[model samples]
Target: MAKIRITQVKSGIDRPERQKLTLKALGLNKMHATKEVEATPQILGMVRKVEHLVTVVEVK
Candidate 1:
């Protein structure tokens, strides 16, 4: 399976609870934190939810 690097570029201080949970669901915590996860439909959905707070990069 391939991996994707998800980097948190913005703060979640004032974000909605749903979006905050989405970040946690993506394995991200705190600003500038990054996590590598498999490219899956669920991940894509989460990314789309909080796209403003993160940057996604393809990783092998």
Candidate 2:
């Protein structure tokens, strides 16, 4: 499977609990944090949920 880099670009403060939890589930705890993960359907779905809060890049 391909991999992608997920970066937390925005603050989760003042956001809904669900979004915050999603961030945590993606291994993001602080601003500018980045996690390299497989581009699985589940991960993609989570990213879609918080697309505004993060930036994604396809890994080579």
Candidate 3:
């Protein structure tokens, strides 16, 4: 599977609980935190949920 880098660009503060939890699920706890993960559908779905709070970069 391909890989992608997810970075928490914005804070989850004042956001909904679900979004905050989604950030945590993606292993993001602080701003600018980055996690490299497989580009699986389930993980993609989670990213879609918090797209506003993060930035996704495809890893070559």
In terms of lDDT, the best-performing candidate is: 2
For every candidate, C-alpha RMSD to the true structure in Å: 0.9, 0.3, 0.3
**What lDDT tens digits, residue by residue, belong to model 3 across residues 1-60?**
999999999999999999999999999999999999999999999999999999999999
> How should the candidates be ordered by TM-score, best one leading?
2, 3, 1
Error of 1 at 26 (Å): 0.9
Give the lDDT of residue 11 in candidate 1. 91
**Segments in model 1 whose C-alpha atoms lie over 4 Å from true places:** none
Mind giving the per-residue lDDT tens digits that candidate 1 earns over 1-60? 678999999998898999999998888988999998998888988999999999999996
lDDT rank order: 2, 3, 1
User: Model 2, range 19-43, lDDT digits (tens) per residue?
Assistant: 9999999999999999999999999
Q: Where does candidate 3 clash, by residue pair?
A: none
Task: For each of the candidates, give the backbone clash count.
Answer: 0, 0, 0
Whole-model lDDT values for every prediction: 0.92, 0.99, 0.98
Model 2 deviation from the true structure expressed as Cα RMSD, one decimal place: 0.3
TM-score of 2: 0.99
Candidate 2 stretches with Cα past 4 Å from truth are none
